[model samples]
Target: MGFGDRWRQWMMSCISIPKLSVLINGSPTAQFGMERGLRQGDLLSPFLFNIVTEGLSSLFQKASNLGILRGANCGNGVLISNLQFADDTMLFLEPRVEYLRNARRILRCFELAAGLKLNFLKSRVVKVGMKWSKSNVWADALLCKEGSLPIPYLGLQLGARSNMKTFWNPIRNSIKKRLAPWKSKFLNKGGRLILIKAVLASIPAYYLSVYKIPAGVANDLEKLQSADGKFSVGSFRIQLEDSISDFSVDHKLVWQDCCPPKVEIFNWQVLRGHVMVRQVLHRFGVVQWWEVSSCLTDSIKTWFQGWHGLCPSISHRRVWDTLFAAVIWSIWESRNQLIFNGEDPSLTQAANIVKFRTALWFKHHGRGSKIPISTMLLNLIESCRESPPKKKIQKEEELIPPFSLGLKFNIDSSARCSPGDVGIGGILRNLLGKILGMFSEHIGVYDSNTAEMTAIHRAVTMCAETPGLIGKDIDIVSNSKVTVSWVNANGVGSLKHSKIIYDIRSCLISLGNSRVIFNSRASNSFADCLAKKGSAMEGDFLSREFQ
Candidate 1:
C-alpha cells in the first residue's frame, strides 16, 4: 500500500497501454482500447486483484469488529471472517438471517465502491451446523444457492476428512488427465522417465503442497508414472533408500556429483545393485552359472570407498565424485558396446572416454569452464589441484538426550520400492538412555515419505497410550527433515502425508508438552536397523521393552 510514486507511475504506464486484439475465425480483429479491468493472463493481474480484494477483506473485518457480522470461531478464541484467493472468496459466518443480510449489504456496498458486481446466481451459501430449512432461509436472505459440506474450493474438498481416499480423487484424476495424452505415444525408457519427471509428477504438486496425499492415492499416481502398470523395483525411490541402507555413511556421494541427470540416474542404479551386470544376470539365471567369472565381485560400497580413498584433498573431492560417476558410466557404456554391438572392450579406450566425459561435464556444468578440456584430459589430477581450496567450518552434531523426567522417541522408516513393502520403526528411551520400549512393523505398501510420517505417527500414538509416559515431556526424533518440519509446522507447507500428520498433531495436543525434532541419520541407527528388520519380516509387529 506504501508503493513509491515511481512504482505507481510504472504500474499505471503498463496498465494504461493495453492495445489488445481478439481473434475471430482465425483472423485477428483490429486493436482496441481495454476500457477497464486487467488482461486475463497478465503477470500483474493476481497482484492487482489481491489489492482490490483487500478492500473487501478489510470491509468484512470491520463488519465483524462492529458485531454486525459473525464469523466462525476457531480454537483459543480466534475468529476467521473471510479467505480470498485470487477472485475466489470464502466467507465463514454464523448461519443466521441477520448475518446473511449484513453480508449481502456488505457485498452490495463493495460492488458499488469497487465497480465489481457480485455474482449472486453463481454464488452458493454453505451452511454448517444448521438445519436444512434454516440454512435455506439464510441462503434466501442472501439470494444465493444453498450448498452442502465437502464442496470443492481451490481444487481441494472443504469440510472433508483428509485421510479418506475419496478426498484425493481430484489429484488422481488430474494426473490421469495429463497422462491420457502421453500414453498413446510410443516413448523410450528415457523419454518416459523425462515425461514422468517433468509432467505427470507435477500434476498433483499443488494438491500435495496443500494436503497430505493418502498412501493409496500416492501409489496410484506412482503406478501411472511407472513404465509398466506395476511399480518398478529399480525406481529412484527404492534405489535411494537402498543406497542409504547399504552405505549408511557415504550414500550422499551418489547425489553430490555434478554429472548430467541421466548419468547420475545410471550411477544410482549401479550403487543400488539394480544394474544388470554379469553378476546380477547370473543371479537372475539369465546367464549360465559356469559362465560367471571366478573373480570376486566387490560390493558397491567397497567400490565407492575405493574412489573416496583416491582423493586426498577435500577441495578436490567434488571433482573426484564427478570423475567417479564418469568412470562408472564409461565402463557401463563399454560393457553395453561389447554386449550389443560385438565391440571388444578396451581398458585404455574406457579410461580415455572417462577423462573426456569428465572434462566435458566439468567444462559445461562445473566451475572449471575456463580450463581447457585437453589440459584436464592430459593431467586430470593436476586440473583438480588447480581449483582453489574451499575451507568449510562444519559444526558436528550428536544425539541429545531429553530432560531427566522426559522421554525421547527416535523414529525411522524403510520403503523397499514404489508401492512396495513399507516398514516403520521407533525406539522410546528415558533421559538416562535406557531403552523404555521399541516397535517395528511392516505397515503395508507406501512411499518413503509416507513411511517416515507413519513412523512419527506410530511413535506419538504409542507414547500417548503408554500409561507410564503420561504427562511427561516427550521428544520425537526422526532423521527425515520433511517429516519433522511438516509435523512442527502443523502440516502447513505440505499435505503429502496429511492423515498421519493430523494424527501426530492430535497426539501431541493430547500429550501437551511433546515436540518433534530432526537429527542426523547416524543418530537414528537403532530405528533404522529396526525398520529394515520390519521390512524383511512378514506381517509381524515386534515390540519390546528392556528393564
Candidate 2:
C-alpha cells in the first residue's frame, strides 16, 4: 500500500489462442463484439492474439524502460490506481475544494485532449492540511495534520484510518499482492500462462467462498476444487494450508497459493508537548499585528517571524505581513487576558517604551485595519468552543458498521493527551472469542485531528488490501464521533470541517463500499486502551492471544 500499491501489471508478450480471452476480457467473442467469427471447431482467434501480443510487447518495453528511468514527478501529489489498464497511471495532489469544480473540468479537457478520459467516479480530491505529506514519501501510514486532506488525483480515497478493518486488510488482499512480483518478473506470453495458473491457484478459498474478496465466489470455486468442499459459503472456513492436491483430481498436483508470511508490525509515537505555545497564544488573539507596531529591536522582531513558520527569505512586504499578523494577534490576546481577568493594563509601564513607540508608529502609519477586531474576537471563541474539550469526551451513539458486527473493531487516538504522537488499535473476533489478527500503530502527530486522521488512513488502506476483517456487517469502535460520522456519510462534512471529511472519505472508499459506525469510547476500550498505552507505545505489538 505504498506509492505503487503493488498493482498487478502484466506485460503479456505472447498469448495462447484461448487463454488470452480469460486473462484480460474473458471470452472476447461475447465481450468484444466479435461473436460472428466463432464456430464449433474454429481455431482460436489468431487475429486477436496478434493484436494482443503487439500491445503487450509495447507495454513491456515501457515497463523495462521504467526500471532504469526515474518516473515523472507527479509533483507534490500521490499517484494511485490505473485508469483502465496496467499501462495507464493515476496521479494526485492537494488544494482547496471550492476550486475543485474548475480543476476537474480543466483536467477533463486535458484528459480528452491527452487521449485519455478520467473515470470521474474513480478520481477524487481529499481536503487535507495545506502542507500534508508535502515533503514525504507515501507513509502507507500517515500522521495527517489537522483539517482536510486534498486527495487531488483520482476519486479513489487516498487517506488514513485507525480501524482494524482497514489496517489488516492487506493480509486479506495478500493473494493479489503475492502474484504481483511474479507477473512483473516475467511478462512474456508463455510466462503469462504460468502466471495465470499461479494466480488461479493462489486465490484464498475463504476469500472466494464468502465472496468477500473481489475474486470468485467461494462456494463455486470450492465445488471445482472438491466435492465435499462444496458447503454453503455461510458455513465455509478458510484453511490456508490446504493443498491444491487435496482437490482429488490430479497426478501429484502440489500447489500452494502465493501468500507470503505477513510482515511483523512495528509501532512509533511522537514526543510530548507542542513546539509552539498555542494555548497561551490563544489567550491572545489569532493574529498579532500589534507586535510589529510595538517598540522592539529589528533583530528580535525578525526572530519572532522565523519561529512561526514564515520564511525569512521572503520580500519585505511578505516579512512585514508575517511579523505584523503575529504581533497583532499576540497583543490582542494579551489585552483580552487582562480585560477578562480584571487585571490592570498600561502600555506606558513598559521599560522598552522606545521600542513600543516604534511598534506603535509602524502600525499607525501603515494602511492596516483591525476594525473587525470585535468580529474576529467572536469567531476565535466559537472556534475554540467547537473543539471537543480535552477533559476527556466519551459519548455513545447507535452502533454502526464497519464496527456493527458482533466482533469489535476497537479504535481510539492516543495523541489526544500525549503530545507529538498518537496510536490506533483494531481487532476482529468471533463469538467464540478467538482473536483474529489484531493491528495497531502509533502515528506522529501534527494536530489533534492528524492522529485521528492517520488512524483513519490506516483503516481504509488496511481493509482495502486485506480480507476477512469484515464480511456483511461489523462494529467499529471509536472515541471520536466526528470521524465516525464523517466516514459513514456518503458526502463531505459541513464547511467548517470539510477537509477532515474529505480526507476520511478518501480512505474509507477502500472499505469496498460498506457503512462503518461510530461508537463511544468506553465501548471501544480494547482500542482505546491500546492507543492510550501512552508514549511508551514502543516495539512490536499484537494483542495478548485471546481464546
Candidate 3:
C-alpha cells in the first residue's frame, strides 16, 4: 500500500475527530468539525509533513528523466533538484508550461491523497542563473509570487558571499537588539561576563559555522562589551585570564567566534587593530629589522602582504597558518599579563611560547607537515626557502603483513588539540589486500588518545559485524602505540583514558578472535588520511566509503 493509504488507515483506526473549541477574539465562536488534518501542537507534525511531501521529490525525479521536467545543472555535473525542509519546498524547474502543469497536478494529487494543502500565495517561484521574461506566466500558472535570486533561504542570506557586509547585518542587528535592554540595566563585572558568555556569545555562533565575522562586525560586537571595556587594568587582567582559561589552547571557537571572521592569517593581520602589540615587535626589533613601520598593525600588514605577494604554495600556507595562530595567541596572553601583573611582559617570553605552541600544534594537527620545529622556531621563512635538490623518498620494505585468513583492519583518529574536534576512521582489507570497507566520522570534542582508542574499538566492532567473519581470527592495526599497549595489556591504561580503554577491551571480548598490533604511521597512511578528513567535518558522522 502507498504511504498515504497506510497513514489514512492508521488515522482512521487510531485517531478520534472530536470537536475542538474555537476561540475567536477571546470568545468561543461555535462548535465546529475538526476539518484540518493535524493537531496544532503535535510533536510528530514535522515528521509527518516530510513523509507527506516525500512523494513530490520522486515525482519530480521521474518527470526529469522523462524530459517533462528539468533542473539546472551545476558546474560539478550534478543536477539541482527542489530543496525541501519539512513543509517548505523550493522547486527548481525550467520556465516551461508543461513543467508548471505537471507540478500543479502533482501538488493537487498530493493534497487530495494526504489531506494537506500547499499555500500557493505564500510560495514564490525563484529564477536562478538565467533571466526569464516569462517568469510571470509561470508564477500565474503556479499561483505563487515571482521572486529572484539573493532571497533568504533557510536562515542563510542565500545569494551572496557569506563574509560580505550585507550577510553580517543580521548578526550586527541581533547584537544591537540584545545590547539595548542590557545597556539600561546596571550589570556588574561578573554579571556582564555572564551575560556576554551565555547570551551575547551564543547569538552569532550559528553564523560562525559558515562565515567568519568580518572585522567591522567583530569591532561592533566588542563595542557591546563597553561596560567591561572600561574596567580597571587589574579587573581587565583577571577577566582576560578567566576567559582565556575557558578557551582551548588552539582557541578555535574563541578566535573564530569573534568578528572579523577567520580567514587567511595574512588577512587577519591586516584587518585586526593592534594598538599595544607594537611593543612586542619593537622589543624584538622585528619591525626595524624587517624594514616595516613603527605601527604594529601596519608593520604586520606590510610584512605579511609582502610574504603572500611571493605567492606561497599550499605547504607554505599551512606553515604560516600555524605560526600565525601561535603568535596571535601568545601576543594576546602577554597583553593580559602586562596588564594584570604590573610587570613588563617580556617579548622574548611571548615569542618562545609561540614557538613552543606552534611546534606542538603542528606536530599533531598539521597535515603533511615537513618543516622541523627547530627550523620553524629559528626562522620559518628559511625552512620555506627552496633548498638544494635532494633525493626523492626511496620505497621502503613493507612493514604490514597480509592477513593469511579472515580479516585485517587498520584504524586511526585525529584531533586538532586535546578536548577539540576529533574524527575516527578505519579500513578493512582482505588477505589479497583488497579493501573490503572504509569508514570515517567526525566525532565531536575528544582528546587525541581517546579518539585513537575509539577508532580501534569501532574497527573491532565492525569486524565482528562483518559477514563471514564469525569465529574467525581478525587482526587490527593501529599507529597509536598507546592504544595498542592498552589493548595488549587487557584494558589497563593511564588513569585519564581508563574509560576508553575499558570500551576497547569490551569490543575485543565481543570479537573473541581479534588481536591488536602496532604499525608504523607510514604503513597506515590510508587510515590517517581518512582521519584527517573526518576531523575537518563539523558533526558526529559515520560514512561508509566502500564495501
What TM-score, computed on C-alpha atoms, does each candidate reach? 0.34, 0.25, 0.34
Best by lDDT: 1
Mind giving the per-residue lDDT tens digits that candidate 1 earns over 1-547? 4568998888887777889889999999999876667788888876887878888999999999999998999868999989987678888987678988998999999999888898889877775433478878877897889897779876778877788888887777887777776665643345466756577777778877877877887887787676544446556666678676554435568776578989988888887778887778988989866644445345775778787888878768878898899988887878788889999867787778888888888778756877888888888866855455566643321245763358888889986655568788888888777788888998877877888888888888887887766678888888889777888883364655676777889899898788898888877888888999898777667985533
**Candidate 3's residue-wise lDDT over 193-231, tens digit each?**
675656877888887887777788787676565554354
Q: Which candidate would rank higher by TM-score, 2 or 3? A: 3
Encode model 2's per-residue lDDT on 1-547: one tens digit a residue.
1223233122121221222132445534432323223433444444444433343334433433454112233546533211223344332223323223333444455556444455544432232322345323222113222333323223222343313244224433564455455544543346365555555456554333433432333433433323221344433433422433243212111111111111000000001112134333544665444333325534332443344345333223332332333344445446667778876646644323323332333334342234233432333222112223356654432232243335545556676443455666666555444555466665555555556655665554555455654343434455677766666666664454577667556545545344456655666666666666632466535453332
Cα-based lDDT at residue 243, candidate 3: 82
Model 1 ranges with Cα > 4 A deviation: 1-47, 54-94, 187-193, 228-547
Q: Rank the candidates by TM-score, best first.
A: 3, 1, 2
All models: lDDT?
0.78, 0.42, 0.67
Q: Per-prediction count of colliding residue pairs?
A: 4, 74, 6
Model with the higher lDDT, candidate 2 or 3:
3
Q: List the residue pairs that clash in candidate 3.
A: 212-261, 213-260, 213-261, 214-260, 215-260, 218-259
